[model samples]
Target chain A: MSVTILYKEQPPFPVMATPDGDDLWLTLDDLRSATGWEIRPEGVCREGQCVPIPEGREREFVRESPPRFNLAALARWLEQPVLHDDVHGVWFFGEAARVRRETLRSLQAPDFRLPDLEGRMHSLANYRGKKIFLVSWASW
Target chain B: MWQGLYDELKDRSFVVLAVALDSGGVASAGQWILAAKPTYPCLIDERHVVAELYSMVNVPSAVWIDEAGRIVRPTEVAGASDAFRTQMDRKTKQVSAEGIADRQRTRTAYLNALRDWTAKGAESPFAVSRDEVRRRSSGPSDEHVFAAAHFRLGEYLYTQGHREAALPYFSEARRLHPASWSYRRQTWELEEPGKAGGPDFWSAVDALGDRSYYPPVTL
Candidate 1:
């Protein structure tokens, strides 16, 4: 299953678990909430996890469920922190869970396949028949 | 030691594949592996797929897979050698944290024993036989399974902008699986009445305000 975390004034952070695997889509709000400083392709920090928000095309959509208080206006009233991405018109809130629990070494590992920096798809099945030692670390 | 040991045994029908769980993606993990420059195959699991598959609760936990693709050993913290233990002991005392010595001592012994098994395979005295491994790896109970489902549902709802709706599911998950840090921490992360990064100031010690929800984490 997938989940999305959205902010009042920004886009949403979409975490989807597809049949093939899981994919993460960050809305402008997601980018802002994750990192105090927002710029597409720049780093956003949420709960100590830093995520890279790449620059992309922007789109406008209406909210199906508008609160009695305009979330965007309320966000301003509450003085909630807002960060902006360079390429997108959307704003971001910097208070979302940037890292999922499944990413931790303590959690059960899910099977997945995704392209590498070289654009090659890699999966756990590729390393079957050998002893595997998986270590997780990041630059930031 | 992992590299040295793996190299020594690779020719003997033993292969070591290092999987990196770095979410920063392959380039980040790749740099570290290259710096180490070990001979073994280093792989990356950017999202921690192996961790979830093995129910790994901590780093350095390892599973021994036999030739038949069965896990000869479930996830357990593999200790380093005796020499490494001595170095760790020295470091622990230097840091001087309370209980550090004891924790280090236990960790050292665990690692040393694990290395012994890694070298000896099933021949090592510490090596558990196939039957024992199977017996130890019985799946989580029906309660845990249901709790995991509820916890996932709660997380999903919380992500869907339904914080209020998510509360009951989180509560139910806590009721079903008290020992699971995932359920407890995820709920606790939300229940705190502040922004995401704000501290969890509520000292409710027992996440289940009602004692009937489940047992305490300490229990």
Candidate 2:
């Protein structure tokens, strides 16, 4: 069997899939390309951050059939809200925007690491004591 | 826009940092920064993380942080000073067939509010409470989350030199978030042919009709 994966922005792409005990398994490469995430030994990683996949859950996610990951299990590990249309073989993995919105109520800015044009790393933590007038503009 | 504000407020323990969300390429953005010769830090957000972090749907959005690092104002269409509006009016006049009367008025009112906030600080009526900020910006929904994901993917693919592969994702993102001019503007400018120097692009017939993209501020 095969499954067609549909993400929010990109066109739908299909990958070969096979039925497991009760879940469907997709190849590691397909998952990585579709989601921009890789299931490393450290669990799932993008950019530099890695979320360590817990011990027993590793077995639950990985299947020997073409060496793939279970779609449901991957979404659970990432703690992302997911919606799937089984008949259509489509899946949408969303970000933590809801959590982000809630956190905004606390007025505490979310922290992330970014590089300045000079190639120096600057984290929001560095600006902890200083006020930031974060102006978002475009050259266009 | 920030130069005078930054210079004047610098002695008052205030600082202005501009985050340029120029995804297609950095050269033009860099050039603009050089011409301005700002003392404040101007950072580039190739992936537009800062926009996503603040749920900003358009360029020129700003978030005001208090001395304690708390958000005094959530992301809003923020450039109130005359300098900024004059610059905007000049550019919009050149490109847009219609006069930018509405946008000019909006910017004038916004600058007034900004002055009040700067003067009064915590006591200012313009400074929103934490709850009010969140409520007004409106908590993100599934569409917002999905749009953000698509935007990131599109930006990544485009920067990777996979322009063909990136187009569909950009289309989908624009479809999902019609109000988000930042998504469309960045992509559209990349598609722009010839004419490549210093702030020429503005609302075109194709860019969601020839109107001021900036939504009116409540303040």
Candidate 3:
């Protein structure tokens, strides 16, 4: 499973997925609030695991455990991220969780067949034995 | 990036396929592809069936499938070349100064990083390891899921001329998934009074009715 964030319906940045066999989608705000990192060009931090947000030159920090509990790390361990809405001050936890690039032990890439401009069939199964790089783009 | 790289590695057991998600069918996407004249298998996804299947929500998104039909790189696969950004930035510096430059700059940077990963593959400095990738791919809560459903239903209804009915779905989509661009864009487009072909209808949220209707766009 994987997590994705959408803005007005379009993907704004790269979506984040967690490990632990859960697939969930997340927004940038969702990641920031859960990790306690400002959305500014700094770094992403939670309880124990923190990833540096390097847009420009930024310093890195060590992942440390909190005395009581690393809620962020616990979220990571559980394969879920905390989500908060600044607009409504509402918060919730996602059930299905996933992380990006983690070797998908159960991920099955969906098969698809679609026509091109000339109405020719383009199928995913055609590239069964080859390393296929599929990209999606639009004119608009 | 993949195009040129594919040319280099195609004979070495590598293949690259480009799918255009253009809603205007192949006409627009084909024109662009032909102009670039990419040597790879450039196809088109008119109905967005592949997008729906792969959970693709944006353009220029990529997925890498190994020979075993396993997804080595999923929906967030970025491109391999920074050519798009370099050209965009250079043109922005020379073009008209109507705020389009800033927009182009930001968009260009985003595309550049994607290209870097594509070119370098897993060796790319920006490429996340299997662990990091998994850690980052998790999605939002159920509220957002229902919101996405509502947004899709609203878009379907709006297209069917059920504007009033669509309004409720769009409203719910926004309320449930406040961060969704699909939900917000659909609603904004419906309420927009401007000409359709002029510019992006929801280019600026400030022009929309209530700023509080959407979340802050950090990108």
* Per-residue accuracy of model 3 over B1-219 as CA lDDT, tens digit each: 356667666764567778876434565577887678887777776434455445555555677665677665556624323222223333234434534564456456645544554556556555445555345444445565445545555554455466776677667766885544334443554645322222453233335445432221221
lDDT values, one for every candidate: 0.44, 0.67, 0.49
Clash count, predicted structure 2: 0
* lDDT comparing candidate 1 with the true structure: 0.44
lDDT of 3: 0.49
For candidate 3, what is the DockQ?
Answer: 0.23
Tens-place lDDT per residue, model 2, B37-109, is 8887777777677776678887789888777778888888885322233343453445232235544566667
- State the DockQ of every prediction: 0.09, 0.37, 0.23
Best of the candidates, TM-score:
2
> Model 1 over residues B1-219: C-alpha lDDT tens digits?
367666666765566655554433555556776678877656565434454445443344466664445555655555412222223333233433434565566555655654675567667765556566645454454455445445545554555466786678678867876654434544655655331122331233234354322211110
Ranking by lDDT: 2, 3, 1
TM-scores for the candidates: 0.43, 0.69, 0.47
Per-residue lDDT, model 3, residue A134, is 82
Best model per DockQ: 2
